[model samples]
Target: MTKAERALETRERILKAACEVIADIGFENVSMRKVAEHAGVSKALLHYHFDTREKLFAEAMTHSFAQTGTDLDGGDADVPAGVLLARIVRTMLPTDEELRQDWKLWQELWVRAQRDDAARHLAVDLYDQLHAWVGGAVERGVASGEFAPCDVAAISTLILALCDGLGIRVMLADPRVDLSTAQSTIWSAIAPSLGISPAFPET
Candidate 1:
């Protein structure tokens, strides 16, 4: 690979390793040395890319969030907006191993945010990004006349809150709350507001 490509790859490896280390342990326990070792890179290289633990944590969290969903925006244009929305919702849940790891990292962030100002800001920023992502789909559906014109912001916030609540239950292995049930519950609550069927769209 070219020098730029190699550099990018190394950065990605370090960030991913940081996510796994932080999730496996907690933010308070994560160190630059630990992350460098996990990434199979030298400590100097890790420091070169991320000068501080805070910076590493921030980038790692952002990287983890970016990997949560499929590229819905690049998906088939012919798919209904509702289906795309469903797919987005599904991505937020701990439905697979990678997503489950992402959820664990989120859990770590939530705990850290309770006491750390920087973590709290990062948490809010990440949530804002998530809100915009969900809101974009809702706005598109309304513009296409596929969904009822309602408060897009309110609907998006509700969807994200519902997902967070149900996702925690699924991650905890709550006997009554499986992935399918959590999905149905969300769809049942918001479908009416969007003028879509309560049945979860097959995504």
Candidate 2:
């Protein structure tokens, strides 16, 4: 591999490891040594990539938030309104290991942001981006007649807030609750407004 490629790979590995560590222990307790250990690299090497613990965490978290929001733009690309709304709804649940990490890390970041200006700014920015994206999907869906003529902004916020609350319930229960149940509940709650019935047959 080229030198640049190796550097990029190492950087990504460090960021990925930092994301998991922050989720596990949080920003206050997170240490450079711990991150290095988690990444399977020496402390010196970790420092070579990120001179300080704060830089390492901020960069990793920025990367994490990007994944959650950047795609939300949907780039004026023409997707079916219903499909877009469904996509927005689906991003909320944690269906895999990495997303689970992102979910936990987001909570940790929220608390850390309370006292740290930089973290706080990042946190608020991410939230606004997510809200706008979801709100846009709802608006488009309503305009396309995919949903009833209702208040899209309010409903989108309601849906986002519900997902947040449900996420907390899932984390507290943590694997004991089947995710399908939460997914179905969210779908059911919005289906009527979306002008569709739940896909599952009612007993």
Best by TM-score: 1
Q: Residues 1-203, candidate 2: write the lDDT tens digits.
A: 99999988988888989998888888789899999899898899899999987778779888887776345436765776666666666567665676778888888877878888988988778777878888887788677776678877677777788778776777677664556666677778877776776652221
Error of 1 at 46 (Å): 1.0
Off by over 4 Å in 1: none
Task: Compose the digit string of candidate 1's lDDT tens values, residues 87-186.
Answer: 9998999999888989989998898899989999999999999999999999989999999998999999999999999999999999999999999999
Please report the TM-score between candidate 2 and the true structure.
0.78
Query: By lDDT, who's the top model here?
Result: 1
* Structural similarity to truth (TM-score) of each candidate: 0.95, 0.78
User: In model 2, which residue pairs have backbone atoms overlapping below 3 Å?
Assistant: none
